[model samples]
Target: TQLLEQSPQFLSIQEGENLTVYCNSSSVFSSLQWYRQEPGEGPVLLVTVVTGGEVKKLKRLTFQFGDARKDSSLHITAAQPGDTGLYLCAGRPGNQGGKLIFGQGTELSVKP
Candidate 1:
């Protein structure tokens, strides 16, 4: 079975601080996606890294995929209250119909 595991399941930090969340797996994925979800809403896609050792950045956030395609990381720089949300990593299992396996997710709270 394909599984994604996330570290630092909960995080609370003052505004302007930095944090990094990790996702790991034993299986290789063709692609990996990161999502951020606010309360009462669906998760929004943050980034998708398809290549091994690939890195993508969006403003204060950076996402990296492992060289083995079995892990990924998300780093936030100078986090703000607006950044508080749930972070999730998901990957397709290289199967038909494109089913996705999701990580446990990390809940982040950036306090002012």
Candidate 2:
């Protein structure tokens, strides 16, 4: 069984604060993806990292994949109230029938 563990299960921060959370696993994955979901809506894909040591950025969010492909990190800079949402990490195991393994998820709240 493959499991992805996300850190800081819950976060509450003031606007303009920066934060970084992580997803880790013992198993190496073929690919990893990040998603952000607001209440009453489906999760929206943020970014996908397929190569080891790959890094991608979208607006104020930055994502990095571990060199070993077994971990990932997300960093948000100068967060705003609108950034409040549930962040999730999903991984596709190497040759595992195409099923994605999900992390426990991190809930973030940014207050003005």
Candidate 3:
């Protein structure tokens, strides 16, 4: 079984602070996806990194896939109150018929 673990299960910071969330696993993945979920809504796809060492950015959010494809990180610069939400990392195991194995998720609170 593949499992992705996220560090700092919960985080609270003031607005304008910077933060980084990590997802790690011992198994290799074909691809990894990051999503953001707001209260009362389903998660929204933020980005997918298919290549090892690949990185993608959306506004102030940056996502990076590890060189071994077994880990990933998300960095938020100048975080704002609106950025407070639940962040998830899902990996597609190469041998698992492309099904996504999700991490426990990180809950962030950015207060003004």
The lDDT values for all models are: 0.95, 0.97, 0.96
> How would you encode candidate 1's per-residue C-alpha lDDT over 6-90 as one tens digit per residue?
9899999999999999999999999999999999999999999999999999999999999999999999999999999999999
Residue-level lDDT tens digits of model 3 in 16-107: 99999999999999999999999999999999999999999999999999999999999999999999999999999998896999999999
Error of 3 at 84 (Å): 0.7
Greater-lDDT candidate between 1 and 2:
2
Which parts of model 2 have CA positions greater than 4 angstroms off? none
lDDT winner between 2 and 3, please give it. 2
What is the lDDT for 74 in model 2? 99
Q: What lDDT tens digits, residue by residue, belong to model 2 across residues 1-112?
A: 9999998899999999999989999999999999999999999999999999999999999999999999999999999999999999999998888899999999999999
**Residue 1 displacement (Å), model 2:** 0.6
Sequence-dependent TM-score of model 2: 0.98
lDDT of 3: 0.96
